[model samples]
Target: MNDLVVQTDGLTKRYGERLAVDSVSMTVRRGEVYGFLGPNGAGKTTTLRMMLGLIRPSAGTVSVLGRPAGRPDVITRVGALVEGPGFFPYLSGRDNLRTMARYRNLGDHAVDAALARVDLTDRAGDRFKAYSLGMKQRLGVASALLGDPELIVLDEPTNGLDPAGMADMRALVVSLARGGQTVLLSSHLLTEVQEICDRVGVINGGRLLREARVDELRGEATLRVRAAPEEAAIAVAMRVAGENSVRRTPLGLELDLSADAAPALVRDLVAAGVDVHEVSPTERSLEEVFFEMTAEAPTTKEKVA
Candidate 1:
């Protein structure tokens, strides 16, 4: 079987005068949680729509499960919840699933299994209109989980969730991946994506900026140092980490050197008559990296997997 569950080649979408999704090529491997990250209006939803065949792309192609996306064969093997859940308000949560299952010619056991997977079994008898926002989201996920699809796509699954609800949703997604499901999740929640996704594709201004494992996207770890006699400390940092690798920040001088070099850096600082106040290691968080990428103009594409 192919390792890739989803692949898009130069996927692009335009809206008359506005470009919704620019040329984007990305891949999602089977059994990994792939995060589609971007800000509002950055085209995360647009790209996902194209992949699910919910909307036609202006240009480019989407292949799901090694076949053209949206075909009956492919769609049956993939499940998704985009924009939000829509169920009959008058129907109980259990009935809603039953109704949907009937449409798909699925059995009652499937509906029961779906509700259980989303932890909605406790509220399965409650009316859909009475469910909270988080419950509704989970019910939407339950619907997607029907029929045991191989790939699941969730768009902003924690959009309106409280902190606790968000944590629950994260745990659910992690559990899904552990159960051998490929998930392509789209969200603006940097911390959630960092905590759950194995790989991420960053999009901004309708274009894909970079796609790689979360760690790779964050780049390397750096040594942070604060010392008196700033000029001398900077000189020492430049010599140790190269002039181009040394930069100033509110935290102090950041050198593109690993934490293992802390002793060497401290020694150099002291020899240069610099009074080192602090020396620690820090790495840029996903939030910081996201801001930096979105702030810049679209650059050459990074490695995509």
Candidate 2:
């Protein structure tokens, strides 16, 4: 079987004078969570909609599960929640699922299984209107799972969630991926994307700036050292790593060297008679990368330990 569950080629969308999404192309491998990350109005949602066939692209093509996206057979294999889910307010959660299942030609057992997968069985009897926002989101996920979809596309699933709710959502997404499900998660939250996505496609101003594994995009790790005679410590770091690679920080000196070099760097500083209080590895946060990619101005690297 092909490993790629989703693929887009030159996916572009225009709104008369405005270019909503500029010639974007991306791929999502099977069984991995792919985060579509971008700030507001960056066209993350638009691209997702195009992928799901909710909207036609001005130019480009999309394929889902090895078939042209938007075809009935292809749509059946993929599930999506583009915007906030809308359920019949008068119906109970279970009833709502049952109704949707009926539309999908699914049996009651399918409804039960979907509810169980999302941990909504306990509150399945509660009216949709009475369910909490988090519960409602989970129900939406349950509905998406009704068809036992091979691919799930979610657009900002944590949009209105509180801290705890966001945590729950994260766990849910991770659990789904662990179950061998492919997921395309669209979000503007850098932390959430970094925490849950194995790979990410960063978009800005309707343009895709980069696509890379989360670990690769994290860049090189820096050794953060807190030592007395900071100048001598910095000098040692500059000697070990290039001078341009060493930067001063409020905490101490930061050397843009791999974590494996920490011991050697520390030994050099200590041999130089510097009082080494601490040595820790610090990696660039997703937020830093996001800002650096999106901002027009040159970004100054900040120490983060």
Candidate 3:
């Protein structure tokens, strides 16, 4: 079996005068959650469409499951919920899944299993029009889960979800990966992506800026310390963390040293007659890093508005 679930080589898409997606290449590995992140109109949706063979790329190519994207055999092995769910409002959620299942030649058991996976079984009998935005999103996910595809592509899957609902969605994604399935997730929720995705591809201004592991993108963790007598604290931090390794921030002094060095640093601070107030390990948030990477790129129309 191919380790790469999805791969694109110089994928490009043009919309008349506008370049919707520039030359881009990305890969999604098997059994891992790959986060596709970007601001609105940053070509994320366009790239996804090309991958699904919903739209032909103006240039380049996309491969799914080691074959050309959109091949019948390859597409049947992949499930996707993009843009938004479109189902008959009059139909109950269960009926909606059943309809889709039948079209795919799947059985009723698959419908039930999908509904249960997304925790929509209790509301399966409710009409689609009566469901909340979050409920509708979950129902869409259930529809995608039908047939138990090897790879699932979800675009903003947690949109409109409450905190609890979001947590449940995160767990569901994690569970999917654990069960030997790959997920290609496009989300604006950087914090959520950081928590769940193994690696991420960040795009900006119709260009892919970076592709890396979550930790690699965030960089190394650092030690943050707050102590009385600011001058004394700075001296101690420099000596303990090595010269030029400490920087002053509004929060406190941040050192390049690891958390394991916290004990010795604290002891040194105390020995220097400094009153220690707080000491904790800190890591950069994905949101912070995202802004820095895209700061130089032009803002998309959605962001400008």
Candidate 4:
């Protein structure tokens, strides 16, 4: 349809001297899952608030589902779980859902179905005050799902969740997307972003760093060849890498690059008369990519800061 579910351009906000959210531009494709990832105080919450219209932007604009974000007309197609889902703490989880339904005018079955979706039906009757942190989080998710929204935005849904709860949250998010729901999720957990997000926008210090598909962000095909006689392997590695980091291991030196690039590096090694053996990549994890991209050692960011 060439339509975007969420989009922003130069969407900025500030409070006096502090720019809470820098000029940020982002887009969520009509039917794709997009994750917003950043560290604490990276302006994630501020940006999200702007997107949802909870607060007015100091400058810039936001559009959701083609309408101005937070416009009354947009709420029907959009659901949200922001800042851990504030609910009536005095009400039972069941009552909380029931109250929300009253306003949506959703059928009685809708609440039960939503609770079942999160596997919190058994705990529905528990008072919000008495529920564990994870249970509360689940209830919030149930609330967001009540209206069968096409686009759902969640912020830190796994906060204080135990491992099992986190797993459940992940399953629900993926299941929602599979069911044709578009989700915009924000989280500080890099692993969660890598797991459930199809694409991600990395934010740092109130700025957008990059956005790419999960696979592209991780990069494919780096082979680590650990061979003995470190000095000899490096002589060959130098020709291909020149500046890439090469660590000395007891077995050999590790070569970091794409698998396709591996052939060129290998060819360089052969041309340099170095024998290569035992090549493998250290496990591929988002953590590795995160560290590699955001490494604080030194870069343009620091140069400007």
Can you give the TM-score per candidate against the true fold? 0.90, 0.91, 0.94, 0.84
Give candidate 4 regions above 4 Å deviation.
230-251, 256-277, 291-305
lDDT of 2 by residue, 1-305 (tens): 99999899999888776788888899999999999987777778889888888899989898889988799988878888878789999999999999988877889999999898777899999999998888898888888888788899987788667787789888988988998999999888889999999999988777788999998898878889899898888888889999898888887788888889988887888899999999999999998988888896232222000
Q: What is the lDDT of residue 112 in candidate 2?
A: 96
lDDT of each: 0.90, 0.86, 0.92, 0.80
For candidate 4, report its TM-score.
0.84
Best by lDDT: 3
- Tens-digit lDDT track for model 4 on 1-305? 65688889998887776766778899998667798887667778888888888999988889988889888788777778888877898899989999998888898798999999989988888789998888888888899898899898889989889998899899989989899889999987888888888889877667777778888877655568754365667776766766466656665666566566777776666676767776666546776776665664222332110
Query: How far off is residue 162 in model 1, in Å?
Result: 1.7
lDDT of 2: 0.86
Better candidate number, 3 or 4, judged by lDDT? 3
In angstroms, the error of model 1 at 229 is: 3.3
lDDT of 4 at 7: 86
Q: Lowest summed-lDDT stretch of 10 residues in model 4?
A: 296-305
Q: Tens digit of lDDT per residue, candidate 1, span 1-305?
A: 89999999999887775788888999999999999998777888888888998889889999999999889889889889999999999999999999989878899999999999878898999999999998999999999899988999999899778888789889989998999999999988899999999999999878889999999989899999999999889999999999999999998999999999999989988988999999999998999999998888553233111
RMSD of each: 4.0, 4.9, 2.1, 4.5
True-structure lDDT of candidate 4: 0.80
lDDT of 1: 0.90
Per residue, candidate 3 scores C-alpha lDDT tens digits across 1-305 of 78999999899987776788888899999999999999877889999989999999989989999999999998889999999899999999999999999988999999999999989899999999999999999999988889999999999999989999999999999999999999999999999999999999999877889999999999999999889998999999988888889999999899998889899989999999999999999999999999999887775553210
> Which residue pairs show backbone clashes in model 2?
none
